[model samples]
Target: MAGGGIGGALGGLIGLACAVLPGPAPIAPVSSVDTSLWSAATLERGRQIAAAGDCAVCHTAPGGQTNAGGFALETPFGTVYSTNLTPDRETGIGTWSYEAFQRAMRKGIARDGSHLYPAFPYTAFAKMSESDMMALYAYLMSQPAVRNSPPRTKLPFPMNQRPLVAGWNWLFHDERAFVPDETRSAQWNRGKYLVDGAGHCGACHTPRNAIGAEKGGFAYLTGGSAEGWDAPSLVGSRAAPVPWTEDTLFDYLRTGFSAEHGVAAGPMGPVVAGLSTLPESDVRAISHYIASLSPRVDPAVSADAAAAHAVRASAAQTLDDEGGRRIFESACAVCHAESGGVGHFGVRPLMGLNTSVALATPDNLLHVLQHGIDRPATAELGYMPGFKDVFDDRQLAELASYIRARYAPGQPAWRDLESASARLRAHAH
Candidate 1:
């Protein structure tokens, strides 16, 4: 249901309707740049710049419709798809003027001048410069056009409506262009622009308000999520038992591994894998941007003297059983062993992963073990399977307790899967 077979067919129908409609496009025209301004080198730069925007990862359909717009973007309110940005006369942006493109990209308005749902992160992009905007347009103009139409989403009652989106915009969106802080070095400012503007990483990584818009005025990198994956804070000051240094974060961003951080899991896993395809320089730039943020130490972490040293002195033990180790060897060794048994099918190292070790709460780990986990929970494009029926509470606890000791933080601890399962069910999207 989450992937194309049904969603794609439905989305394609919706795309056809929107493409066939006759009227002003949802966006307005953008000002022109001299064609001479876009030379071969500039086009290449534009291509790299385009990757920073990460368009294909969100817009393309499963089994790859490249830019044809049939993939579903799940939200707390409803699901949406990446719109066609191809130059197709009917199914894409063939007739869009520069001004309209700018408005849509920066203001969340469509060529038709209608408001777009914030699921598209124009609020962050609104900070991008007009020149860079031209570059993006050039890049998009160069891509191949696919003719598929996506489904017309069926939203519940009032949430289905649009005009109200304008009001939502006024309350939550920031309309200003970015102001460079002269006090900061040029590299820092460039990093800021890339992350806050074209990258749009904050759209998912940042915490949201009751109304679901980002809590913008905050340092802009504290983490929050409703999906099973909890985006850790980027601030880096939090005393996670696993330390994330610049070198560590950079390696993970580039090759998807660092001694401190493992390959990304959940939604982040796919994102990093995609980012890995991008040039290393751009990835480094992204690191520069994130590293510039002052690490904010959470009160809970800052006040804990034990966690500061990452010491497990006070953390509870997960097991009291002699059979714990044998249970793990029999049931989990294939995926958790050092011979690299963990592969792309949601089998993570399970060792040294912070989530596995966080048995204090145990909600995330238990939910995955009980129900299995959907790695790319929304769909493949990224795939993580669910395992609910595989093991009951007691077996899971035994295996989990053993694995945590061998691989996760020190002093492996046992937990109540019943309580964890209930919490996961109540909050699952």
Candidate 2:
């Protein structure tokens, strides 16, 4: 009797383990929605959500049919091609049921039961509310379907196996939908939902672990690099030249440029463009939430820090080299040295107060020199041409070093500048 009881107990334990081992339930085809039945307001709402999510920026390729994806997204492991989100019968999600779309967004599973690579940012999307998810679905399905097949993603070795992604998801994914903080005000909660869920700001702003999953909690939004440009910290120890005020942050997010900071470029340009379409309240909410993340510094404290930084910069200027000085005087001074006036192409920025110059890292400066600023020309803003063609690696290094010495005195002189310049130049072309 004792032996039989032990055998049953062991069997029960094995059964329990088996039941809990599987991560998410196997996905099935969701019931299709009748597009005609979707309300016009719902469709419009979906359009706004999609814009906030910047879905089209990643999905649409340059000169390609909108939503017919072909853009190559570079990752540490390999390049991942964006998929065709358009509802084409053969090449796109035309056959995808609403269930299938939800599974992909919330569970990172493709319509065919294949696990999607995290490059699609499903990890962040997983936190979206069910209603918003459905609205996004409606909007995507309503778009005109284009029969364009983007190139297949070819990852090397073990990463090529779709089954491996299942393990990755199990390790990093949180299956719960976003829950609001009841203690917080409605506006704050709205901002959190927009940024943490659909906007997926942390996808770029937050650092990742070994598996490319976001490092949440205390490390969240403390700055991370993406596609060669550093997305500076949004919280503690803010990196923007001038400390961010709510209005300034809102303006920057809404217009893509701030008088205090600088214009958005690279990946940020598209984000700003998308945010421009969102409601003024939505943008203001984002600014409010971001500002709330870090403690506000006293004006005197900020002034002291600035003064110290300037003193260090002044001391370092004494060590500037003649070659770099000559280069700056010849090429950089016309715009940079003219006091109380706009920069080249009417850009309103001061290098001394610019974060790119004053920041500890030289990467942002390198990026600007290599690629330059090219925002859409408007009555208010102008463009600055890149200097990659004119400046060789050595000369560029000298110029960069000189600028750092003059504008950001206390920062250490950059080493391995030649190598950095070479890499930037190679990638530029």
Candidate 3:
């Protein structure tokens, strides 16, 4: 009777677990294909879809094979290693059936019935259309199957338990395809789909709750942290003095640089680099959608905007007795203050107008100062050597304060700069 009672309790526990799950268990794939037999156009479309999602950016490790995974994505919980998407039967998704793949993409369920961590950004992918999902799957399966197994994710204690993720899904996951807004223009709708669904821009751009789940509704895509860099706000409370026009956004997205905004650095650099591969129309659509989110007035006509743009200190004012200015003259003024000339390194520095210095928070400026800007994706853009070794915490603070005051005059002084610099330097590793 005791044994019977124990068995009954075990069965009850299993039932409860199943009930809490997002969906039924995925069936294992029975067959394996050596080659993708998809049409050329379909394959090409799949390639575009994969690029739109920037799949390779996360899946591929630095100097590693494409989609071979093993890239470590750091989260508040811990580090989650990316899974191989190649066609390798053992280490990758080669054995995954269409149903299993669909469930994994839309519902965050793995083929063996394990819960995939949200670091995979499946929440956003859940909004992807069925056709796009299939196309992405095809593109990944067609890649050369690298027989590499990535390290398993190691979360702390209770968080490591995979079953707990079900509760996370129950609270946050939306297992549905994207539904277009019929009232909006096709370009607008397309942008919405790409941003909200396939591109999952909010994964990095949107701030998150305490649980690391992204905050939705009004808090959507305002600003967030990526890796370590603070992703500046994309709305009207944007970092730049001159508001982002669709054309400027398009330029930044397509080429990783805008004359007005300066060059993309840190995490944004790679993202824009990947975006360069996408079609111009798609980038334009994304810009249009993002621009619609904010109520920024055109910088051309707004006198307020013109005044803000003119906030930078004049050359004479740059020589003030403030310790910040003295430091800038000694260290920063050479390359940054020098004007238009020739060749890659000869390109004039974008002070005063740089979006990085103009941001409300000094985090981006701190990031660039600590790590420096390196545009390796395009050698033509040149690079800025990191001054972390050269400047101690106090010096770094003074330098950041100087840049903000001299270049971004209207913006208030960044508070607690010394502590902020110290914190940033601590994480520089």
| Top-TM-score candidate index | 3
TM-score per candidate, in order?
0.73, 0.86, 0.88
Better of 1 and 2 by lDDT: 2
Which lDDT tens digits does candidate 3 get at residues 1-429?
Answer: 244543454345445556765545668675876444777777777888787777888999877999999999988768999999888888999898878888888988899988898999899998988887877777777888898988988877556767767767877788879888899999999999999887888998899876678998998998888887778778775577667777778877887766666677788877777677778898999999998998855746443553445443445564343877777777777766634333346244467767778777788888788877765444456777788899888988888888887777777888999898888887742
Q: Which stretches of candidate 1 lie over 4 Å from their true place?
A: 1-38, 237-239, 295-318, 321-327, 334-350, 353-356, 359-429
**Top candidate, metric lDDT:** 3
Misplaced by over 4 Å in model 2 are: 1-33, 297-319, 337-346, 375-380
Residue-level lDDT tens digits of model 1 in 87-137: 665777766777777888877777876667888888888988877887778
Residue 219 alpha-carbon offset, candidate 1, angstroms:
5.9
Candidate 2 per-residue lDDT, tens place, 1-429, comes to 244543454345345434554534455544444688789888888888888888888999877988899988888778999999998878898888888888999888888777788899888788888888888899999999899999999987556766666766666788688889999998888888888888889989898865577897998998877787777888864455457667767877888766556677677877888888888999999988888897875545655554554444434345547888898777766765534333355665556656777666777788888778775423355666688888898988998888877776556777888788888776641
Give the least accurate 10-residue stretch of model 2, judged by summed lDDT.
Answer: 1-10
Q: Which stretches of candidate 3 lie over 4 Å from their true place?
A: 1-19, 34-36, 302-311, 318-322, 338-349, 375-379, 426-429
Clashes per model (N, Cα, C within 3 A): 38, 1, 0
